[model samples]
Structure formats: C-alpha cells, structure tokens
Target: MKESIFHRLYDTYHQDVFQFLIYLVKNRSVAEDLSHEVYVRVLKSYDRFEGKSSEKTWLFAIAKNVAIDYFRKSSVRSSRTFDAFDWETNQLVSPTKSPDALVELNDDMQELLLALEKCTGDQKMVIVMRYFQELSIAETAEILNWTEGKVKTTQHRAIKHLRELLTNDTVKEAKSHESK
Candidate 1:
C-alpha cells in the first residue's frame, strides 16, 4: 500500500511539484532538492492526512513550507538582517528551463519572470499557484493556508505589479535603443 501510494504520488505530482519549486527558487538543482524534500514529507505524513484537502493542495502545502524553510535557513546562514522571503533584489536570477523550453521562452516571458521575482513572497506564491500551476482559487488558498478572498486579492495585485514592471522595462529598453 505504501509502495502504491509512493508510485501514485511520483506519477502524479513529481513534475508539478518540481515546476512549482523551480519557479520559486529560480534554480534547477535547488528545485530538485526541494521536490525530493516535499516527497519525503508527504510520505512521512501520509498516514496522518485527514483528507480535508485534496492531495494536490496538501502536496503543494508541503512544498511551500519547505521553500520557506530553505529561505529562512539561507538568510540565517548568510547573516542577512532582512527576511529573505520578502526581500526584493534587482539581481534576481532567472529560472533554469530545459533547452527545449529555453528556445520557447521569449523576451516577454523573461521580463515576466523578473517581474515575478520582484513581487512579495505571498504575491509570487499566489501567482505561481494560480497561473503557473493552473490551480483553482480554493486549491491555492488551501496550499497557502489563506482564504479564497485573500488569494484573489493577492493575485490581482501581483498581476498589476507585473504589468507595471514590464511596461517600465519596455519603455527603458526602447529609450536605450533610440539613444544608441
């Protein structure tokens, strides 16, 4: 039974979980490690799962906590005074996509990813779950331990922020090219 559950989770959620982690971390190797951690957590807690939420949301919840823990530990280790989860960095790195995916990612998509990096952690999480992962509002709320209303509000704010960021970037690029 345990083996079957393991197989089912691997078959169903492995890629989605990895993608979610990769989007958050902006690094392939780190996402893989986090994905593994999520799987381990689910397996350990499977028996205790009360079925109040769907398996997907439960898995995502584990992934979300794992990411928060990673950022916290990283911040502590680096002696950063600020909360890393909410810190915005202009030098935020782009997420690593497969070669095939890289070929498909255009300038707009790159800009969008950068804009996403500038968002607060809650905004980013809401966007990634609602848009990137194609999860419903309720699922996102369950995963984030928030209300559906909060999820909708965060997503709206995130989209508006992204639009502003992308528009400004575009204007700057156009001006630079004109100057050249």
Candidate 2:
C-alpha cells in the first residue's frame, strides 16, 4: 500500500477504532494492540476493498471484527472489570468547575461505565458504537452486519438496561447514606 493512502486511513479512523476497542475491552493497552492489528489487516487487504460502503464503514467493520476476535480468544478471562478512571484529573477538565462539582462528575461517569458493564455483548456493542463512538444507526448496522431495525432495537434495549442498572445503583447509594 502506498504510504499516503495508509497515512490517510490512519489519520481518519485510528482514534475511532481505538475508542471502540477501548470501550469493548475496558483496557487501554489491549485496545491499542487491537487497533494496531486492525491497521495491519487493513494494509494487507486494502486492495480487496470494494466500494460498496463508505471507507469509514469499512474501517469500522474491520475494527469490530478485530475486537470480536480478541474477545473470543480471551473469553475465559473476559470478566475483568474496568479500573476506576479518575475523570476529574483526566483530559476532560473544566477549570470553572468547583472541586465538589468535579468529583460529582467523575462519580457520575464511573457509575455510567459500571452500568454499561452489565449489558450483554450485543447490547454493549450497539451502545458503544451508537453513543460512545457517535456513529449513526446505519453505520452501526453496517459495522455489526445487522439490519437497521436490529440496530435500533438493540440500542433501545441497551439504553433501558443501563437506566435500570444506574437507577438501582442510585437507590442503593441513597439507602446507604440514610443508614449512615
């Protein structure tokens, strides 16, 4: 593959691919390795890419497959949980926010991530692609090899499940505070 073409592809889709893998595995190092593998596969198969879909869609499809393969190989150990990410101290900072506000925001983000962990694999994939990666429904369907209706249904169910989990968490926290 020509260096320019490869560079363009990397520049256009690398971050999206990395983010998708990170969301799937909840581990930055694993995600980075998978992202590199995706690029390797793309370079090998670039000539076979027919123009049936947009390049973005094609790239995402490749990424989704790579992540799936990683999951399959590590299924026995896949139950590993995400470490607590310090959102307030991460790059998503707001200087105007008070310390209390920053801590609240971090807590909320952590809660949402934890809630997402309870979803089934299919539901989690749709949720990450649709919301976290900000892909459109059509693009998500193409990447997942599902019908548009299936994508919509999966996203709806995932959102409902997440709401239930987060609500339960909130209730439990409230009860604990009351008991305190």
Candidate 3:
C-alpha cells in the first residue's frame, strides 16, 4: 500500500512540481534538482502523512516547503545561464513563420517575463501556481500552507505589482520610441 501510494504520487505530481519549481527558481537545472529533492523528502515523510488533507494537497504542501528551504539555502548570484530561454527566444521561429507574428509574440512575451521578474517571491509563487500551473485557490493555499485569505491577498498583490511593472515598462518603451 505504501509503495503503491508513493508510485501514484510520483506519477501524478512529478511534472507539475517540476514546472512549479522551474518557474519559481527561473532555472531549468535547479528546478530539476529540486524536483528530485522534493520527491525524496516526500518518500521519507510518506508514513507521516495523516488524512488531514487530500493526497495532492499534501504533496504540493511538501513541495512548497521544499522550495522555501531551497531559497533559504541558495544565494542570489548574477548568472547568464537562464538567459538562454529569455523572452527573446520566443521571437525566433522556423522559416514558416511571418516576421510580424514573431515581433508581436516577442514583444508580448518580453513584457510578461519582465513583469514576472518584478514580483516578490511570495507573489510569484502564488501567480505561478494559480495561473501558470492552473491550481485552484484551495489547492494553492494548501500547497503554500497559507490560509485562503492569504492566498487571495497574495494573488491580488501579485497582479497589482505585475500591472504596475507592465505599465511602467510600456511607458518607457513608448517614450524611447518617441525619442527615436
């Protein structure tokens, strides 16, 4: 039973957890390593899982905690590693694509990514889980081990901050274009 449960969770939530960690950390390699670490911790704590929450919720809660621990231990260093996948990559496509389409896509992607970078970690996690990962509010709260109210507040703040960043960016771009 224990092994079956572990297998089930591994299959069900592995990809979601990986994607979540990738967005949070903004690095593919770190996300992959942390995803594996999350599972290891989950396996060790599997026996301690009481029935207080659903299995999915419990697993995500563990993942969230692992992410927090990772951030706590990690030091922020300037690195160009993740820049390979930055918004500019979205502009490049096969010969089949039109130049206008590429330009529009790149502009939109750049704005979104820039806005995302401006968000606080707490706000970013909420946005990533809820919007990017498509988790429900309850599930998000469960994963973050936060109250529903807290989740809602974080979501609001995230959106507000993102909007401000986008607005400011747009103004700057317009001003630069006008100057040119």
Best-performing candidate as measured by lDDT = 1
Residue-level lDDT of model 2, residues 1-180, one tens digit each, is 367888999998898898777767766677789999999998988898888888898999998888766765554244355444332122211112232222444777767766776677778788888888999999999988889999999899889988999999899999999999
Q: What is the lDDT of residue 64 in candidate 1?
A: 92
Worst 10 residues of 1 by lDDT: 87-96
User: What's the CA error at residue 32 for candidate 3, in Å?
Assistant: 0.9
TM-score order, best first, reads 1, 2, 3
> Per-residue lDDT for 1-180 in model 1, tens only?
987988898899999998888778877788889899998888899999999999889999999999877776666656656644443222223344332343457877767877887788788888889889999999998888888998999899889988999889999999999999
Which residues of candidate 1, in runs, are more than 4 Å off?
A: 80-104
Candidate 1, residue 146: Cα displacement in angstroms equals 0.7
Compose the digit string of candidate 3's lDDT tens values, residues 89-162.
Answer: 12211112222322445767646654776677677778888987898999888877789999999899889978
TM-score of each: 0.88, 0.82, 0.78
TM-score winner: 1
Cα lDDT for residue 100, candidate 3: 30
Segments of candidate 3 deviating more than 4 angstroms: 76-107
Question: By descending lDDT, how would the candidates be arranged?
Answer: 1, 2, 3
Predictions in order: lDDT: 0.80, 0.76, 0.71
* Candidate 1 local Cα displacement, residue 84, angstroms: 8.8
